[model samples]
Target: MKPIFKRPRFGTTSTAFWAATIGLLLIIAAVAGWPNPVIFVMGAILLATGLLIWQEITAGLWIGLSVFGLLTVLHLTRAATYFQLRYLIYSLAFAQLGYECWRGLQRTRDGIDSEDIDDENGDGEEDKPMISLVLLQRQPKYLENMILTKVVESAWGGDYSNSDAQSDDDADDGDGFVVGESPMFVIKAPAGMFLVHNFDVPYWDNKDEVVEAIGELRLRNAVEEHTAWLSVDMLTPGDEEPDLNEAYLLVAKLLTALADEDTLAVVRPESLDLNVWSDDVVARLLTPGAYEELSLPDNAPVIPIADDAPEMRAAIATAQQRWPEFADAFQQRASHDKADDGPSFVVKAKITAGDSTEFIWVDVIGLEPKFVHGHLANDPVALGDLKLGSQVEFPIEDVCDWCYEKDDEPVGLFSLEAIRQIQEAQQTNEQ
Candidate 1:
């Protein structure tokens, strides 16, 4: 697991107390001519705290801290006789700590706090709720008006009364106004208010490796060629029961109005996952209680509603029809052309035993004349002894779907898409 780092919030009275305590300890160590283990232990603790909890430690800081720690330990163990040299090193470490504390105090006085710190890990504990969209084309003129109109017409109905609109002519005229760079608008809804804005820079500007590592192939491809992006952040604060349902609906409508074939991807940054979007995807988004369901942890498995639904059959047919494309892509993978493209390339196929049949993901390891060979990516519900990572082979005709990451983008996900479509249709029929 990756180590999670967080910035320390300074400028508190406790910070002032620690600063004074360290200063007193340093003074005691310098006057006594004795190796102050307390000071050394404190130094080590501070360095560790700075590294793991505070600001991102630089290479220079790391080296300095490491040397200080090593020397302190050596001095404590009575392995060194260089008492003067040890005192000098201790003084330098104290100076560094004092400087950092002073900097923190200065920042606090300027109203800058821990919130200014970049939460790179995206654990979402400290961040606000937000939805972001990236597209391959710039949005149309009067984007705010378009979004508001769509939101009002959606399943979760709401209206935005724009105070900026002057006269009837201004509201009706085609030559109303040109949207400036990074235009922001407030949307007043039944749930609460939302802030929508277009960003000047694309969100995925320098994060190519992140996208690739996460297996968001579609999102990766979109970012590579994206021209525009926007964010919708919930503005109304809530204690317990926030209007998350309406917020999702608002995003759904926004996507309905703005998203097209050119739209790249929709993302909830807090969740740190790329949402797959289709025309029918909006229907799923608008369903009651979907927000809570989607907000579940990423590790949870998504069980399909049915194994033999029409959408499943349709997905299998589509994958078979597009089998040539998968074969060609596989051939590319076999060659050095697509080396190290992703972690795994797998296909979903049907497995049967007794009275049970289930579709399972299988990692692609080799190819045969009439069969695709690989290990099972998922444990079977019915098949015994054969567990996850077990070698499995299936004929080409039984393959329902295939997915591989190439060029930092996902290539095929027919069955996954079909499952979503199936869920969307079912929800719609129920309504």
Candidate 2:
């Protein structure tokens, strides 16, 4: 048997019809001069009060009472001619007010709460799949007319919003984003569809500058991260798993080009799903020198993932699938095989001498005066650059700690995790 469907009592069409009828009456009353425009406007307002119980009980009640009081006073004091012309209009408003009061009370007695109205009408629908992106130290100039645009254009499917207003050159300008400005855009690709929008970083000193790039990916999901890493937010259609193959191809094309330019980046999805990322794309990013601290600007921080983090493991495993060279390099670095003669307690430290601190990690070999004895970490791209892996000594008070490698004992300035693990182990042993 076919299912029976009931018509909604207050659907859009019925509401529109009533609203239109009242509006037409207001226009006719103005022409005939039967009632003042104020009376007809009050009548229209009463209709709104009848539709919304909360409004009728709240502000609407006071408005209705005031209008009636004013009209009654005017009727008693005014001449016969004045009362006769406006009587019909005033009566219509009064009848509307009475109907609103009656309906509002009836709805309240029936236990129909205002909040449930939207649920009954299915007004709050689920959003489409989406993801967000954030880019730091952004160079919009690099994205202009580059191979990156070509890849995105090649996958150009179409967009929901106007695309004619935007061009690669237009997006390249710093005017696209100003301090406190968040612009939104939509781009379609054969691989997937998504939106791009900006968010403010209030804590950042350059809040007003358009130097940084931050964006969202509608139809894809994003996860929060401590470090400045590019998030892989590929979009997908509803009720469908993401097409990993297409996403991988797109990422490979984009990241490979980025790496060729020696761009130091750390990109991850808002949420990590191994099935959504192919092996090639992961290897391209995690490849040893692809995004090493040494390759970045002096003192530029690394991605901040712990040695044993799942993301690092995933990258390593993905690298093993297609890029053995990157896999080997990633494993070596993840193992912490950097050259240093200092004790395990002496973690990597950055020197803060002046306006710009030294950009390389130093080996703290001595205490008392706090001496650093080592060359700056070598940058693969610019090997042996000046000040890199250079030996320098500073007061113990002058060094700023960036990160701590895993180590045992109450070594100098170890990470909180290392300290907590040691205390737990010691407690268990005593027990």
lDDT of 2 by residue, 1-431 (tens): 11223212212222222333344445445445366777577556645533332323334434444544555455534424443323433444444444444443454557554333343334321222234323322322133222334434443322222222233344343212111011222334445543332222221344334122222111011112111222224444323554444454454444343332222233333332211122333454444433222112232322223446544344334322433332233335436755253223233444544443432345433334234344445321122333444566655343333232434334223234443464466469979
By summed lDDT, the worst window of 10 consecutive residues in model 1 runs over 173-182
TM-score of 2: 0.30
Assess every candidate by TM-score.
0.37, 0.30
Model 2 per-residue lDDT at 347: 30
Model 1, 107-153: lDDT tens digits are 55676655554434532223444443333333322355555444444
Show pairs that collide, candidate 1.
217-409, 217-410
Q: How many clashing pairs per prediction, in order?
A: 2, 22
Name the runs in model 2 displaced over 4 angstroms: 1-132, 142-235, 243-350, 356-361, 364-372, 375-390, 395-431
**Candidate 1: lDDT of 102?**
54
